[model samples]
Target: MLKGGCRLNGKKRCLLPLLLAGVLFSCTVTFSAAKKIPTILVCPKTLDNSFWGNVRAGAMTAGKEYGASVIWKGPTVETDIAGQLAIMEDFVNKRVDAIALAATDVKALYAPVKKALNAKIPVVSFDSGLDPDPTLCLIATDNYKGAFEAGEALARLIGQKGKIACIPLISGASTSILREKGFNAAIARYPGIRLVAVQYSESDVAKGMAVAENILTANPDLDGIFAANEPGAMGAAQAVKARGLSGKVKLVAFDASPMEIEMLQNGTIQALIVQNPYNMGYLAVKTCIEALNGKKVPKRIDTGVAVVTMDNFYEPKIQQLLYPAGNSGK
Candidate 1:
């Protein structure tokens, strides 16, 4: 027996064959309709750091778990707003199932993100966010609270009285703006502490080092420093160490990269304000997939942060937070 033909629709087909009397039989048996595996595009601020690397890992892990094809792409530097915008727009035109973006600039990315929304593509903004957010959901750390905690930690290390300077990531980024404000707000609490100089690193390590060196030179008696991101932190640490002011000028930095961790162990960086980048990346893709599946998704998801210091660095939970493998999609 044989069927005339098989109709291929939005379903999967399995063929069962039978042979008898030198005759062959074929039948198209359909299982429940197969769902299309979605292709999700994940764009972080930059493709050049361990933070974004962790995010990529988390996103890929989610894609594997949820039957999605994940495409990771971003600009080479975090300051390349135009580059990131072009990338997003290209993906939108390609009609990828969904887009997970960690915008380079808060306002600059709104147009393309809005365009994606208009095209019926779900957008999930993570890390740095979009202003007038048109995305389906935002997954990020509480940058303000983390920076405030960093300020408080620096204040305590300097014994609540000293000249301190700040090196924020960049001026236009939401993360930069919030962290700078939060640190300033915390510093305002104590009349004895004076925030002497503030500079923008533009998320460049050499620039961060140069900025810190200038600040230290201007205020020879500078007591402490707060660096708001990884590049800034690394640069500040190098500056502090080069001047042989390792433990003298207390430094509290954000994100614990390998260099920062080495600095922490050697008394170059006093504390690290760490975010769950892995969790952030994982949740972003998970949310995008959910939206594509016609499932309800939350408007906001806080991946949270931790203030890490020598006193609690070895704790199991903190260790897991610092290492990506210990806490992927958990």
Candidate 2:
């Protein structure tokens, strides 16, 4: 009764029994595939800032939803490209299913990223993208556009004709460089606006405050300031408030930190260009799943951005998108 030599239930199996056995085997394979859980390694640039924290939240949400084992790790402070690379190397050695990274140094990450690729590991770049790599996919905000929006908002707040200073976190960071370029381009559209000075804060709030104090001391008449990130913005706001020039100097900053939002609500900061960090994280996880499943995905996906001010701060989508779940909606 058996098609081959094997017998089922102590007797030679007929063609019908063989077909039923094949069906059962196929069902077993399907069940095994469905029960398999994917493991993901998420490495943000740093957890010091709320931006990366939001990214971690999104990744965790995805992990929970998709039955994935997610390991979220990063540096305590940014600018530690070496530390990030070392972590990535360890993750690769562990043979994770995939890696999602927010690269601190675009060029410095080349070696480690390539190392992961050579080991047949998929890497997805989120938040901050690395230079074009054939083996990596990028999910991020369009930095240039976001910065341009901040510049336009600043120009409007300062009445188009004013002196503004740019306090960027890092001079060589690719995202910061693009944001500066966009900010400069936007200001170029308005002939009355002039960029007085561009200073590097090295991603330190105290350093940003010190630089802002020195700049304000030198140019007391300056009417506008554009801080490339949240720390610099908060530091500048503190400096302005300390000097009792809160309403006099218009502040337009990047990212919507709780402090920055409070400043906006309190009339200290005029506007902030907020990036969708949650979306960045969600998309990064989705992309990794797709890639691992042998599905095609884009090399770069823009998470888009928004400008947050006092007027629309309470909108539902804005609240959910910015604050996510479990975060104090402060």
Candidate 3:
């Protein structure tokens, strides 16, 4: 009988080293399978709105395509800067393989994003971005250009000469900041167009409507209105409808929500400056994976935009961009 390594048996002796080898092989296979899939944490600015839901869908799609795992979470509202920062810190603490973030406040989120980068986790920013460029990629629409187009569209609707109001979703949001500058720049191009009032909605739906109402009341002779985001557009549409000024005072807004689409269909909204949010979300995750794989990713990736109205909203080509989730025929 082999004292330590063998079982004394009448016939087939079992060796301890052979049994140990089999156990080691099984563990090696299990560990390798688990390590094959990289887990990512995606934190958008807000998940309550449909816009962010589309972003989440895109990220999830990318995750499936790349054989990666994703954990999607964010603040319930876009203005919750502290909450967003806390989420980022928590993801960092969890040691996620990568992170995709949409910053609620650029400067406020900078420190946490930087901390994740310093901790050697790759980060990507989509939609609104973080300052200091801690992200491997910044995937976003050309907000300034889109807003300028919206301004020009409004200017045309008002004969390029009238007192107009600018309603922005959030005063501190990076997208809002760019859109404001763009709208202002476009309005200045025409000597006749005057940007009279600028009121903030703080990214709240009700506040958007209330602010719009106040702007209209304060300027009874206002000719046109430009809403800089989905909520702003929605509120502005409601305000315009409630005042019975639908066709009289043109409303040009950014982003296309179901409500905004219905507004366009009914002539409450004249024009919509739309962005490829799905593309932004998908590319952001793709870039993060690239960075994690030791591949070079571009610092800036621009998702394109389009201006949609009732006249062109149903075009087959446009539907793909506006409804990437296979709603083209609907």
lDDT of 2 at 25: 100
TM-scores, each model vs. reference: 0.89, 0.88, 0.90
Residue 125, model 1, lDDT: 90
Best by lDDT: 1
Q: Could you give candidate 3's per-residue lDDT for residues 267-313 as a string of tens digits? A: 99999898888877788788888988999999888898898987788
lDDT for 280 (candidate 1): 92
Which lDDT values do the candidates have, in the order given? 0.90, 0.85, 0.86
Q: Between 1 and 3, whose lDDT is larger? A: 1
lDDT string for model 1 (1-330, tens) is 125454455122323322332242222222223547799999988988688888999999999999899999999999898999899989999999999999888899999999999999999999988777878888999899999999999999999998999999988899999999899999999999999999989999999999999999999999999999999999999999999999999999999887888899899999999999989989999999899989999988889999999999888888888876764211
> Which candidate leads in TM-score?
3
Clash tally for model 1: 0
**Candidates 1 and 2: which is better by TM-score?**
1
Clashes of 3: 0
- When 1 and 3 are scored with TM-score, the better candidate is 3
